[model samples]
Target chain A: MAIDLNGAIAAIGAGVAIAGGAMGTGMAQSGIGSAGIGLIAEKPNQIGIALLFLVLPETLVIFGFVIAILVMLAGGLI
Target chain B: MLRTERMQKVRLLCLKKDRRAVVHELHRLGAIDLRRSGLQLSDGSVGDEVQQISDMLIRVGGAIDVLRAYTDVKRRSQPTPVKHMALGTLLERLGSYSQIGETYQISAALKELDDQAEILGAAARVANALAGIDIDMASLRSDVLSFKAFEMSADQVERLKSTIGERGISAEVLASRMNGKEFGVLVAYDKKASIDDVIKGIAPRELDITMKELHGKPKEAAARIARELAENAKRRKELQARLRNLAAENLDKLLALREMLEIELEKGNASSEFKVTESAMVIEGWVPRKRTEELESRLALATSGRFEMEYIEAGEDELAPTLVNRPSFLKPFDYLMEFLSLPRSDEIDPTWIFIISFPIFYGLMISDVGYGLASLLLSWYITRITDPDGLMYNTAKIWELGAMSAVVFGVITNEYFGFQVTQLIGFQGIDWTKSITSILAITVLFGIVQVGLGIIFGIVNARRERENKLVVSRSASLVTLVSGTLAIAGGFFGLMPAGPSIDMAVLAVAALLVTIIFGGREATEVTNLITHPLSYSRIMGFGMASIIIASLIDKAFTPNWAAGPLLFIGFLIIFIALHFLNMILSIFEGIVQAVRLNFVEFFTKFYKGGGIKFRPFGYRRVYTVDADASDA
Candidate 1:
């Protein structure tokens, strides 16, 4: 139930990494999502391509998740 | 199965009299994609014929629309059997359907009736509004007095009456409740007075009724309008009944005529692409190489040896259309390929790779027995209800396959709605609680294999295109990707001896140099060799997220059986609903991420898809048959 200073800082760093990556992903996807809706409205068959574009930014969050895992391992928390 | 069907360019020269027969035969075969001939020839006659058929098509289309609006014509539950006939015979049959003219007249009459009903409906509304006045409508239109009808709130009418009285205007004001809060006020004043300004200041909505047209009292006029509206409705019904009967008798014939006319129009338009002389015409098209002999025999039979046919090799500069034939089960993946882009005729088709990896990715993302079973049932239901030829049905099949894979993984992981199912049966399967590191390692390794395969495919494609530089560069990329991955694993993770790790790192550096020397601008993508494989870490990330979330839901919402029945039942319902929501999210994320990994990450390495789809000339007939028995 208690944590050392180093452990607490590692956890905070992991949270920041994930939060920053998620915010960046969301920002990038907003423009792509709106433009993709317009494209799909004009050409419904392009739904697959629109979806692909909309999800392309998700790798940012995935990378953040990997970093968080590494941080937890270094702090002996996982 | 990895490559597209080969194609050959075909040129056919025929006598002018036999041109129609040859074109008709080609249409029935439905194997060739017609192209414009190189010779410059006038197509005035063919253009005229195309215009004629197009006009007929428009008329037929209009009639079908009219019939559909009037009646709920039953769609055929089963596809209609095709009727075999020559083009001339089909044209004659279309001409014999006399109901076409009757339908046109009926459509015009219906349109007129609609316009009349609209006008009458508006007049009826006005008459009903004025019915409470109990005054002769014609008398309200006196030339010697200023008459006006205003609709306002009852309180506003009271204010207007008092204000007009205060203004010392000798006028008669009549008020009647129209509906709800609305009061109709009619004011008549001396024509010479300036009382119009007083009424306009009230800001009431003025009604525009032609008083001169209503000769009788307002109530009488309302009755008359209602009667006229009824009469119009009756006439519309009778006309609609006649239309329904006509539709019942001729709807199928009209539909067949429309199809035939469309086909004829396309054939006529194709003639514009042919080279025509005074007594001969030439047609050029692309045909699948395997079907060339069939095309030759069919043309020979159709023209009785009057046509001369020759095959030419497609030039290297020309891009031929891509055509790939797969079994029925693999057809759904083809839809995915088409949605992205078709592979070039000479490049490898990556659909087979997707078929192998997409389901694996999906299974890993949503590995749970209960969720997999639910997805399988949902997909099966969608497939049953959707059209077989439509995109929805194909996508459902893809989901069905992914669900099966999910079930297999779910068994291996011993998960059922996040519960350890094997624990109840006195055995233990793979405990995800202890296998996170192993799973992450496996996912990263899978990424390495896929990326390596992609680079190898790129090498094969470059070699096929005789791009020697691309071949060597891509080979170097594969070597670098493999050796660099091993070096990282051994050096950083201590998976092997330090000596081998150092040696692998050296090999990786040497491969990187080769890549830079031959890869041109592509060498700048060296960092992607590390990051792209690391991207596969997402599979583990999402899979663990799903499991953790499901477990949390179960922990939080599980009902206390020891509580009273009512509270326990309430909590149980909430528990079921949350689990259902989690399952749906899992399905959605599973499909999007699985397809994204394949299309965006795996495909970018080698696939440069700008290939034209092979669209053979001719309609897929539902009501008409191929006249040539051999082609059929």
Candidate 2:
């Protein structure tokens, strides 16, 4: 197969978008977890707080899904 | 955040006195359990004749209760201690029996009865021995009591005879007993060693004492004989019939006897109530303040003005109460205890950390929008059953989160189920396969930023923890963040080849080294500080490896569009199986990586985890379906 630079570059853009999305998630994971620990450490009382943070990283993935739509739009896959 | 406040939170909600009651109440209600408690037969002390007689009577009752389990005709019969010399024949004595179940309760009644029987049997033999010698048997019998024990050996009898003869006094010997077990001595005597030595001098190896039921040739032979009897049609049928009839006739009577015997269980036992369903007596049970009114109402209805009711506030004794007939779904997560944790400024709970990273990693590794949707649906259903309280729902919600991530990532790569959609967008000469290179770039890119964030958090936490040294010490993280950022920016901006910005970034490296080598001296060695951040690079290496491995497995497993039915089916199975295996592996690895990040990357910077959590006194029911104790 001939190297399709245009298609490949498009793929790169899509991949970068995903990376950015994943970065948000990865960041949120550590962020929420550490924040939960910090909260638990101080008050040692907030199971609810820790639990909320525990679930917070999921928003990254949820929002990251927008990139897939962007990919479809940008690539004209639709 | 619920976690960041509440330092010096009063976890010890109950006082010592309250704790005692809590533990006591839990036991009374069969809520909490200790592994084992040492309870001796007679409090491990000698007693007067009356006390002794009562103890023996209780023992006999216990034994008869055990025998009643195996046989009928025990309705009116309470066990009576065997009158030592009254029954002169060992053959005529009664023995203890037990119910046969796979996990049988060791019948205390049977054991006590067996001990008393043995004592009386020995006494009878002693009486016979005295009679054989024609001594003042009556006087000797009255002054000297008899103890039921295993059969003594002939050599042991001879030794006794010799010892008595040498003393110029002729004494009567009553009983010679066989052990109920094997490899145990004939008697567990006060002087086991000396007696063993004497027996060794007198008896042959074959005749040395042994434990009953432990191991013995004769018993083994009997067991074999019994098995043979069972195999034979005639004997087997007869035995089976007898046992069936025995069960039919004795079942109800034995149960009734058990209840009667159970009543006796709490007669004098401390902190025990025998009247759960009996006479309406005011029974005080300590409960948490939250449940106090509820319990009062229940008691009021249960007693129906027949007895008084009192609800005591559990002070320090606030153990989780045992709810009777608890459901399987309601099993305690009380192990997730609160502690008087460290003075919190703003750190993170380990559990929350896990909850965030794990699902995202899972989604990234899977990188299949279709698969993520499947997982999200299945996990959502499981959450309803596992965490009805929404605890597990939120945890499992991450799958949906991951699905969303997968869809985004899949689109970004211009791929869906390994199909490139970017070419459809009219992008000229677009090659989707080149997206694989982007996956690596993103992996490293994300890793750099995450590592950077870890350092910032470390600095902030260190400042809050009042560690001035840590603030300066974690400056290396800031340096790396800047250097990595500059490297990516420079590369993107066409400033230089794909190397980190060394020209201006050298200043950051100098500061990084200063913090690492000097600032971290008290916390860690220069070598460790210099090398620790290097460890963060593993996120890139490991994360990339996971995605690549998954992608390869997916490709290898996917069926050929043109293949025959059987071949396609086989490939389909292989595909599903391989991906499933990869998923399971990733679940484990992702969690481990998340922990690694939390403990090594984040915690080492600013976390102090080991403060005893506060535990407030409360009542928690395991299940509503099974607290009645009727089935058990």
Candidate 3:
């Protein structure tokens, strides 16, 4: 049997959090890819800015973590 | 008839005066040669000019020296920028101090320093060549007469040792040679340093060998050779270090002067040729239209007015040489996507699609009016500040655009950030949980469609590549899509018992047949195709997994027991923290699902990536120009 209605709510929240991360990672990885091609076109020095853009998507994960902690505390799970 | 003219732009060959000064200066510098490879200079003066060849030679020579030094440093020490800097500095200092016409003197010094290490290495090698054998002491006492340095390899030497050790001969045996032969044989020796093995290693050498009596001098000669080798090796290390220090002190200066001279040449009336076709060299440059008469006069001095000059107008296309502005946000996206290598060649530009789908999908996935508003505002602001081409200035551009598409579904599903607010507005509340389940079901449906699309594309691309894997894999996928999709649709639509549909089951069986019989293009198995689509379930798994967890946490963690002020503050903190986590999780999950949607479902079937990207030989200027001017 389901633990409670709250259990399903938590389940959905977790899924949304994961999906959010996936979206960001895709954008980031592609950024990294294009940057690689650009650097190769120009040479290694072009890599600095490209690397920064590639890591920028990681902001999503930080946001996801925030949501996760909120969810946990709100439900008294933490 | 269509009126179109194919006219090559008219370029002045030279300024009316001798345009040689700047061209000559730039050739000496490494700027155009090394830094700007695709540099387009009007092919008027740079090439076929005096002193350019010597300049190129010097630059290439310096590069070789630097590369050699880099490898040498890497072998013994960590390769750091500081070491490179030291070498560069030394080159510069030596170059400036050198006497006129004595460039080779510095080069000669560098070469000499480098040679010392090479000589030491060669000397050690020759010594090793001289003392090539592993012989025991007892043999030295016997074979003292005639000894010659002979080359013996590891394997042959091993066999000789084994032969000698097994015999167990004593020192009493004779060491003798034939009168006219080069090599001598040592008679049986007692077991010393595994003697039997030594004899076995000494294979028959056809240097006209003969038997003779014991000798004493050769062993002494071998030991002397070994000593010489050790001393040479020690000297080699000392010499190498000295050369390294010398190079580190002077190499930089020489390189800098050379690079500076090269750039100076480009500033003059020199032209550079870039490769375009097999025979035609492409040279792009500008001359004042009014100055054409003077430029033509200069050209007449070189070619005696034999070469013709022409002019082509650069119309209002916005792709002007003077402009440099690019849409920052859109530009950043391409870099990001390419970094991930998400888009392959066969399909449409995903960037255009993403500009449409991402925001909408994000809003739907989030389902909070407040959060959507925040994203819309943030995206719009960033889009404006980051982009500012004037095309995307409104907040609705990001959220309302994608949101408009996603909200219909969001509203029907009653998902307003994981809760229904209909009752708060004095309306009967719809069962949001049920609608959410249905929405989730729809997400799965889309995933299947996307994956099915992949299989189709995979088959088409495979045929083009002439690879057999495409045929079977794609056929199997078709079968899976047909049977599985029919089953899912039938069940979801309530066409059957909500358990299994006969039509779908039959289609599934047919799909299995096709997969087993056709998809095994690799010849290893048939079950892979049926299972491959299952991998796509990861999309749903990741997406659903995040939402479910966030919702579950919200349910599990809502604060209830604390007092007024503390309780409110605590609740706020928890809500903020959890939302942060949700943001993180959602970002990762969205990327994963997006990738799954593309890579597995779409790309697996449709993507034929790995095409050479089209890069134009346009806008190769070094100076930054106004962004708006880039177009005109």
Say which candidate scores most in TM-score.
Answer: 1
Instruction: Report, for every candidate in turn, its global Cα lDDT versus the true structure.
Output: 0.83, 0.43, 0.45
For residues B229-266, what per-residue lDDT tens digits would candidate 2 score against the true structure? 33444543454454555455545444443333332222
Candidate 1 Cα outliers beyond 4 Å, as residue runs: A1-13, A30-47, B40-45, B82-96, B150-153, B177-184, B192-205, B211-213, B377-394, B423-427, B489-501, B564-577, B623-632
**Clashes in predicted model 2:** 77
TM-scores, all candidates, are 0.91, 0.40, 0.41
Writing each residue's lDDT as its tens digit, candidate 1 over B1-632 gives 67889988888889889977888888878889987766677542575667667767787888888877765655743344454455567666666667877888988998898988888777676667677887877776677887777788988898788988999898888887887999877788888876667767788888656733465876788799889889989998998999999887777767776777777877877787788889998888888899999989999998999988898766658778888898889899887788678888888888888999989999988888888999999999999999888878998899999999988888888788888866576657776657877888888898899988888888998898898887888898898898888898999899989999999999999998898889898878777788788889899988888888888888888899788888899999988898899899889889999988888778888999988888887778775444445346
Error (Å) of candidate 1 at residue B157 is: 3.0
Task: Point out the worst 10-residue segment of candidate 2 chain B by lDDT.
Answer: B35-44
TM-score of candidate 3 against the unseen true structure:
0.41
lDDT (10s digit) by residue, model 3, range B1-632: 01111112233333323333223322222122211223253333344422553455465455436434633433322211111122234345434553312334444555664565455444333333323233543344345333222334445444554554455434332223323333234333333323434443464442211212112233444455356546655665564565455555544433444443333333322333432233233333333234346545544554455444556454443121211112554454344344445343333344554454455445445544433444455556656565332323432243444444334544644544445557675543334333444544455555565556556656666776686755765676577676776786687466566546777777777766666665555424334344444333343334344456656656765566555778867876887688667755654444334433444334444543443332222223222222322332
Complex DockQ per candidate? 0.87, 0.03, 0.04
Better of 2 and 3 by TM-score: 3
Deviation from truth (RMSD, Å), model 1:
3.1
Q: Which one wins on DockQ?
A: 1
Clashes of each: 0, 77, 184
Candidate with maximal lDDT: 1
